[model samples]
Target: MSSTLYAAGRAARQSGDLQGLIDAVPYARFLGIRSAAPESSALLQLPFREGLVGNPALPAIHGGVTAAFMENAALLCLLLRLDVLRMPKSVDFAIDYLRSGRPLTLYADAEISRVGSRVAHVSVRCWQDQVQQPIALARGHFLLEPAPESA
Candidate 1:
């Protein structure tokens, strides 16, 4: 990731393309996660691919992948909301698997429950077709560091 991408994220209100920020992250790019705008809301979308399947028999996406996706979503949400450009470090993370993620497009939305000077708390939910029936849910605390002052 680069500072240029963080600049893009800060400019998203004008450009309306948050996907650039998401794509800047290497893991998100590897997972084929992109940003989707449905109506007036932005969401993280994970497309179905063969390589993401952890169980060939059941053909389900790996649990770790889902967790990582949720965590990334939370991070992206925080990045977009902050005024400064800096990467957040995960202080703690907890996830609950509601159902197996089948071979289908998954979408996630993150909510920032609380934000302090040095820490932020977020909750994320992932679902296939309906948001009400989430396949996985995650909550995490992230350390937010201020950007170095320009010299």
Candidate 2:
């Protein structure tokens, strides 16, 4: 994992806003992310396949895909808090890889650092089998402007 994955997190730490980076999620995943408690943490699991693989020889999961997993996991915090009724959009996100993700099911964890009036922030971490070591980390920000009520 490259150290850059922690980019937003590091910045947020400096700015005292770890929650924004903790909330971004990818555009993939057939099943949405989940949380044990409304305020605990967001968790996501994605199975590896050629669809997620960029190169067949390396069989390494694409960095973008890994980022996506993190993003989905991070954004899940708000969804859980909102009870899946409100849909949040991905305004921006940042990822830092700690190492290369191997071919396997990935588990992602995210913590909400802050959920302000208009912005929800989160931090995400990814790992395969070992929870002790993280393969990548990410930070994301989501805008919470409600959409118009269509008749």
lDDT per residue for candidate 2 within 1-151, as digits (tens), equals: 1123234333433454433334332333243333322223355567666677776788788888888678767655555443222456688898889988888888887787887777888888899889788889888888774323440
Q: Candidate 2: deviation at residue 20, Å?
A: 25
Which of the numbered candidates is closest to the native, going by highest lDDT? 1
The segments of candidate 2 whose C-alpha lies over 4 angstroms from its true place after superposition are: 1-41, 83-85, 146-151
Report the poorest 10 consecutive residues by lDDT, candidate 2.
1-10
Reference-based TM-score of each model: 0.90, 0.66
- C-alpha lDDT of all candidate models, in order: 0.83, 0.63
Compose the digit string of candidate 1's lDDT tens values, residues 25-144.
778778888887832245889998888899989989999889988998998888777654677889999999999999998899999999898999999999998999999999999998
Which residue pairs clash within candidate 1? none
